[model samples]
Target: MEDAAMEDGETNKDSEVAPALIAVHPTQNSVAVAVGSDLRVFDLLGGCAVSLVNDSDGSLHKDSIRAIRYGANGKLSVSAGDDKLVKIWSTKSWRCISSVEVIESLLTLLAVKR
Candidate 1:
């Protein structure tokens, strides 16, 4: 099957190519991209890359990330993947706050203001 990265305009020309899973911050001009096993954040306007969270210390996901989104407050971000788990992360500390499992593949995540 074709990878989602290819659909996102990324090409795999190398042996070590990794799929890209990206999420844009709600209020900031920044974006988060999960390439291979690493999560990278970049500035949209400055064109400079920013590093938000690195799960290199341990495995971030059992498989590739399928979706990511900014929370309602813009202080948190959410990620869901083939692992069948949804992770909540803090924007300030870049730390995982919670993880919840769900049935079937997680297709999307939407943040609602309360």
Candidate 2:
């Protein structure tokens, strides 16, 4: 989940800010989570919350990640953030496959494969 400060008139309110928590897809073998400024993908079936992927290279997003969802093929996962960008990663290799800018602060992203 992503955390953002609410703009209150002229000042930004930080005290009332709340971080977002993203849930993984129920049928996916992996789970994606955004904690603080890092994006982590976990191996759900392994019992231990093992880290399978990480996006902390400063190129992904400066702020927290807002949303994460598995693609229709179950082999890809998409993530969007306040950075106004959407990134798609492969579940098998846990590598970035594509990225697109939507020009708006993306609240969520869903990838469908035909």
Candidate 3:
């Protein structure tokens, strides 16, 4: 498989590199798109990019994000991928509330534990 990143630590510039995953809020008020190791979110109501609090090393995901989902009536967002990390985000604050590291390959289906 081809790596998404380029030599400059940025994603590939190919126009054909489509989003790896997309998640829409239950209420249709927001959308999240995962491309390579980056995650882009938009607020439908404001018609602007949603500001997400990055608590990590200035990167969204260390590896390509394979799965993204919104649950709990769009209050929570979950993202996981080759990094073997499952991250839960609070939609309200757009901040990562928790993260779990797994030893095995990531599972696309994730359920938010209240």
Query: How many clashes show up in model 3?
Result: 0
lDDT of 3 by residue, 19-105 (tens): 478788887678998888788899888999988786865566787777888886888899887788888888889998887888867
lDDT of 2 by residue, 17-101 (tens): 3255565755766667776446777676785554344454436556567777776667777777776678787777777777777
Estimated TM-score per prediction?
0.61, 0.66, 0.74
Best first by TM-score, ranked? 3, 2, 1
lDDT sort, best first: 3, 1, 2
- For candidate 2, the TM-score is 0.66
CA-only RMSD, every prediction? 7.9, 6.5, 6.7
- Top TM-score hit: 3
Model 1, span 1-114: residue lDDT tens: 467867555444334344577777878888888765466677889999754553543556675577777876679887777677777778887777777787976445545343
What C-alpha lDDT values do all the predictions have? 0.69, 0.65, 0.78
Model 3 clash pairs are none
Clashing pairs in 1: none
- Model 3, TM vs. native: 0.74
TM-score of 1: 0.61
